[model samples]
Target chain A: MIPSSWYLILSAVLFTMGVAGFLIKRSLITVFMSIELMLNAVNLSFVTFAHDWHAVKGQIFVFFVMMVAAAEAAVGLAIIIAIFRTRQTLNVDQIDLMKF
Target chain B: MHLALFLIFAAVALAGAANLLLQKHPINAALSLIVVMSSLAVLYLLLGAEFLAIAQIIVYAGAIMVLFTFVIMLLNEGVEEKTHGSRVAKLLGFPAVTVFLALIASIILSSETHLGKVIIGESITTTQDLSAVLFRDLLLPFEITSVLILIAILGAVALARKDEQ
Candidate 1:
């Protein structure tokens, strides 16, 4: 059997990579993808703990998380498209309309 | 052994992440993200969170990622412009990422709580147990999720629509 620690470690690495990508990438789409990566990393941990506890609450929570993610993706992509239409670019640094 | 499976999935996830990071094409990156999400669902199954595994595949790999792909296609963000940041911002990214990583590592390591053996001995699995609790005690959240989805739909439409003014 795969030790739970290995799962935890892999999750940690993936989460770190996601964070790094989010911080480094300037494109809105890339940032959005990094966010998804981070969420999946969290899901990995939640499942690991769920298995460990032999409880379904964690799994149930993951379901809710997925729902939220779906919602976020839909709305977030729309916003990104709107921004692209107005700004003609997806680079966060170049588009500073919201920044004061 | 399960270790081999874990290694394989971890390799796949890493490859997906790399593709997401390195690929210039938004569509390709989106596809890679789907691969990563599906591999994660498989991992969830191994962890005994079967419901979550299935939900992950359906919600993430199936629904959200497809929406992302559509947005990419609609925008036609074919070639991503190289990222450029101010000197300070460029300097800040590494430190910020490092600090966040360190914080997560410390939190995980410092926590002393250990999970006890809870695996059902061929008698019960996660799906049945989760359904029981979800329907019996946590019914409110179950219902609330629908409201959340509805709101998200409205929000997406409102955001996509052009301003009247």
Candidate 2:
């Protein structure tokens, strides 16, 4: 079995990439995807610790996180669709209607 | 064996994440994100979280990404136009994020938290225990998730409907 810390290192790397994507990407949907990637990273870390501690609780937390992510994805995509209809564009720079 | 599996899938997940970030087309980015999620499911399997691995595939890769792709197709917004932010931000930001990752990795690596070195047996028993906890202790949260999903359904329909006045 690999050391649990290795799993954590991988998790951290995935999370950092997610954050960079969130910051550097231009589309609203890509930003949303980045958020999902971040959540996946957290889930991975949780599972790693769950394995390490031999407690099922961390995995349960991952379960709850997944539940919440599903709901968030549904609503977030709907809002994105609404914004697209209103703006006809996916560029985050153009999504500045409330930036005044 | 397990180390090799973890290394392979971890590479897949990271590469897919990078692809998601670099792709100019939202659809391509969404597809890359799906790859990330699927590989994460496999990693979850390697970590002995059986149920969660399946849930990651079904709910995340299957449901959530499909929703993203549907929205992408529905929006039909072609490749994103390049919007150049101020150069200083990029100059300062990329390295800052790299430093942050390095800091986090160092902390995680330096930690001496050793857990059950005893590799557990089949996850079949794990699943049974998980279900017991889910139904007994976690019932409230489980029910709440159903309500959250219901609200999401209502909200999505309300928002995406034609705004006929």
Highest lDDT, which number?
2
Every model: Cα RMSD to truth: 2.6, 2.0
Give the runs in model 2 whose Cα sits over 4 Å from its true position. B86-89, B113-125
Of all native A–B interface contacts, model 1 reproduces a fraction of 0.65
lDDT by residue for model 1 (B91-110), tens? 88778877877777666655
Docking class of 1: medium
Q: Least accurate stretch of 10 residues (summed lDDT) in model 1 chain A?
A: A1-10
**Given candidate 2, what's the lDDT at residue B162?**
86
DockQ of each: 0.61, 0.67
Top-TM-score structure, candidate number? 2
lDDT per residue for candidate 2 within A22-86, as digits (tens), equals 77877889889989999999999998888887778889999999889999998998899888888
Best by DockQ: 2
Query: What's the interface RMS deviation of candidate 1?
Result: 2.7
lDDT string for model 1 (A1-100, tens) is 5456667667787897887778766678988999999989988887777677666787777887888998899899989988988888888688876765
